[model samples]
Target: MNCTSLQELGVDSNGIGGKIPPIIGNLSSTNLSKLYLNDNEITGTIPHAIGNLPSLTDLCLDNNMLEGPIPLEIFQPGWLTQLVLANNQINGEIPKSIGLAQHLSIMDISYNGLQGTIPETLSNLTKLGYLVLDHNQLSGTIPPGLSCSMILDLSYNKLTGQIPDGVAGLSSLQIYLNLSNNLLEGPIPLEFGNMDKIQALDLSANKLSAAIPAQIKGCAEVEYVNLSRNFLQGALPSSIGALPTSLHVLDVSFNRLTGMIPQSLQASPVLQFANFSYNNFTGEVSSEGAFANLTDDSFLGNPDLCGSILGLAPCSGKHGHFLYIAIIVVVAIAAGLLAMVCVVDHDLMKTRLRLTAPSIQLSHFPTVQGNATGKKESDEHPRISYRQLVDATDGFSEVNLIGKGGYGHVYRGVLHGGTVIAIKVLHQDHAGEVIAGSFERECRVLRSIRHRNLIRVITTCSTPDFKAVVLPFMPNGSLDSLIHGPPCGGKPEGPRQLDLDLLLGIASNVAEGMAYLHHHAPVKVVHCDLKPSNVLLDGDMTAIVSDFGISKLVITGARDPEVGEASTSVCNSITRLLQGSVGYIAPEYGLGGRPSTQGDVYSFGVMLLEMISGKRPTDVISEEGHGLHDWAKKRCLQHDVDAVAERWLPRDPPSVLPFGPPRCEMEVIVVMVMELLELGVACSQLVPSMRPTMDDMAHEIACLRDGTWRKYRATGLKAIDQTKSKKY
Candidate 1:
């Protein structure tokens, strides 16, 4: 019989359902270069002989029920470049023969039962760019020679040893380099500073030691660098000041460093997130430049270090009164000159400007209402008066206060027409000359946005000294209050116990609100701060996202500046100046200060995780070890997630249990909780790109809810059918 060519077969989403054909290996003479068998219910083991096709360059067997180890014969040729065998029940070690395929660039073996050491030979592929070996039992040292330039994730494994020195030579590395939650040891290689284009570097929760190498200052393009929970020692490098303005995140907590912080390091405007806590550093902490904004928490647990940060003891010793005197003398001299100039030149300046200026017609302020001709008479736009807002907010009384946040306080008020509203008043400190422009930008953006999930910007008031926004009131309060506050008091049971269904419902709504802001709104708005507190719920429990004070409107068609190449350090500095609260801010924002859609996704992911875990993102448990994400992931892999969920949400059956079986209700709750936990795990993935988009997350939650409801309904129908058959 003539052997059929594999090319003769076309299996691209043809709805072909069933197991892999036993005779698949017979097509040995096929000239096929691509084989896609995704989106099918194909089952059983992959045939060993199936790898005989020498011309195969792209093989996608994902979204299938395929099982067994990757065929060793598949790695024989150098033609293969893309191998996606993910989302399968595949097991066994990756064959070392994979290294022979020198052209392979993208290999994903995630979400499998794979085990054993990573094949060192696989590192020889210099062209490799994306290598994912996550969520496996892979063990042993990472190959030193593997130098993929893009992303190299070896998380959620039993991998050990120091990061190989060859990794430092991946000069094309841009997005991230994560080797967290591993058994890596020894000092971080000084050679890593040579990766000039590295964007984010995470070596947290490892056993690495020694002072952070001064050589790191040479990584001019690096934005985020985390050395947390290491045994590092010695004072920070003064040369850290030489870092390019792109640097944003610098964490060296849980170390043994000492001595005064380098003043130069503190002066860099690009440094937004810095945590030198739990160290042995000594001497008076300086607050000259960017450091002036940092509080004791940034440098906490270092008893010997003193500063002016609130809650910390003030610095003692010498008081410099002469410097204060000199500043007063200079100000007095300038004031005297200003008074003389005002008296002598006031009339001269006005007459000179009128003579030199062009004559123009003046327009009066426009009326608030339109005329019969459908044209406004004045040029001014409608502006809410400050007094009107004050009256609406009951003279800014404390009783009206609903919530307080980093930017300002939110108040619940009722207008004269009985329209309930939320009023936000700027904090006194941030209400300065420098913030006036930002206030205007926010007003302009909020007024233009009119989405259901987004908090409606009814009106705003802006004066030289005061700025505030009026919004529709949310009577049910914020999600934060419900999750973290004391139980509601009116009912016999103190606070209404939060069931899994209710929690998932609220999470779905929050995701929907975030999705609208990220993709559906007229302008792409990044709600820079996305946490429980920012999500408000109305009487019907519909979630509405609030707080746009620091939100950014991403202009369509505008290209983000190249990561490593920008005109001025000022741009990077300006970006870093806007980093929001600690727990919710994306890591990238604290690294290079570059903002992207991924940043908002990361924040959303954190919130999703928080909702499921019923724990604050910054809660002490999270800070002690891996975050809630890591905790949930570990439990999920072990199939013990139900026990973990029960810790946060009790499963006590209702006393007046309905007519339905109690066991059935318990099972429904268990399944719902598990689904929510899985969603949380996906959202808080260590890799920002791996996290689901808000739109996808919302859809997934909706499916979970709908799926559960359908199952419940079907069970009821089945019971009725069984009773009818019994009667017959």
Candidate 2:
């Protein structure tokens, strides 16, 4: 093993389930350039003899059961380019000697038990691209020397003091800078604006004070910024709207910011997510362009901010000029008429005039246009009418009926302009108030939620007698139609079977959409009813989450036992009445638990299992007397991937000549199916805490379509077995 001829060695994810052998460092092969031992079950402290490999350029031993402090001697390699020991129990401070590796470019030691402050010596590694030290117990002020990295993530640490001024001068920082959830205090430095190349910056959950420096507009390339949960005060710089067009997310909530929200934010085309809640902002909230989609939740806790957002009062000065004239005319005419009536017949004429005046006043009410009450061109939506919807849907004809649900029936329609749409008309037979409430709820939810994988609401028509929401028609139809439609439905826009590619793609898209709803949206939304039929597919086979009629907004820190509990009891009752589909509901919900984001995760898990096993949750209960998770877990526990695939696909694995070249594609299929089934089983775990988050699910499913998993499959089932017991 000490031979100098060795150049590279890899034994990754090979089911090596014992302590790492001391002899691993016996490979004194001076010519070795790369050493990969990741994703295995190797344990014990790293041997110091690894420093003998003078020519090593990459050293990866991550995602294992390794414990104890990393050996300091490993940094002796002058040519090392990558060093990853993340997700281990390694303790002790990162050695200052790490700076000696002139070629080091990527270093990830996150998710560890490491302690102590980051070494200032790291600044000597000029080529570093990624520096991740999150989820550690390290404390102390960040060293000013480490300012040139591209991706700097020091979140979830106990670091205090102001951010080092040198960080602002990092011209090479093009990825992200995250220092959130720390005890750092003092004003944000104006120097941050000089980091023009950075994309994302997060300084939330800190003790930082003072106004956000107006110079932040100079961070021209930033797309996302989160300074929430801080002590920031004063008006937001109006120049905020002058930020780069790439700006997508800006959250300054939970602060003491006063005065008006910057108008520039309303005009930003790419600014999709903005949370100004829990602030002291005053004056009218803008409702144009990006603001048109925002709901009252975005401005909650700001009592002084008035706007057209639901629940907020309209500003006194809004339409003041027009209303003033109208009021004066009505008052003068009424006074003159009353005097004449009093003179003509006294009490008799007065009683008769009162009855007629009420009717006349109602007939003179003005028609208000636009989604929001504002004088901005960008707030305009196609002014749709109830009569137009009736005409387009052919008088609600049964022939055009596309689908029906608990709240409404959907009909296919073609408008006068030759645009095709799906009209969701509420069931009028239900109590008019209930129907109206559902419509308003949908409007509020849809207004604030925006994601490519979520359905887009085109326009809405509302009148006393009728109400309907128009959406773009999805020609590819719902996932339910693709999976369980009539046999003669013909080929779909994409694949028919839930193949590895299509299954992973659809699963990834759904996870992304759910993640956005649960975390990234302007306001958190929990889609209480997530199921196959609710997931529609466009022509490109992209999955989009539809039907927010029963969604609930999650108010941060609010003590509500049920969805919408912060609101009236009627709202909570409505949520309970529509608590998701039968088989897809989480176990807790059956026991009177509240509908929550976790419940949605459980439902997605069931849907994932259904996609893989082709068995509904109800079918499992009726036939096997348990949920789908039990059946899948039973097969998984028996190490019977073949049985699960056979029951679902029911086809033999592709056969090739004996001792011939291994079929790489076939390997990927088998490995992916087994892994996916395992993931489904994990997600549908009886304990909600045991279930993986939507973000985690998305990452793992995405791995199935990525090259790393493909290569892992080529290595055989030993690799998949090694990862099964690992954390989600």
Q: Please write out the lDDT profile of model 1 over residues 120-204, one tens digit for every residue.
A: 8986887776576766788899888777755676766788888788875566665567786678888888887788867678787
> Against the correct fold, how does model 2 do in TM-score?
0.47
Q: What is the Cα-based TM-score of model 1? A: 0.46
lDDT of 1 at 629: 57
Question: Which candidate comes out best when scored by lDDT?
Answer: 2
Estimated TM-score for each candidate: 0.46, 0.47
Model 1, stretches more than 4 Å misplaced? 1-383, 428-431, 486-497, 558-580, 620-624, 636-639, 647-660, 713-728
Which residue pairs overlap in candidate 1's backbone?
223-591, 249-590, 366-378
Global lDDT of model 2? 0.73
RMSD of 2: 23.3
Q: Could you give candidate 2's per-residue lDDT for residues 570-591 as a string of tens digits?
A: 3453333422133687654433
Q: Judge candidate 2 at residue 462 and give its lDDT.
A: 69
Count of backbone clashes, every candidate in sequence: 3, 0
Worst 10 residues of 1 by lDDT: 358-367
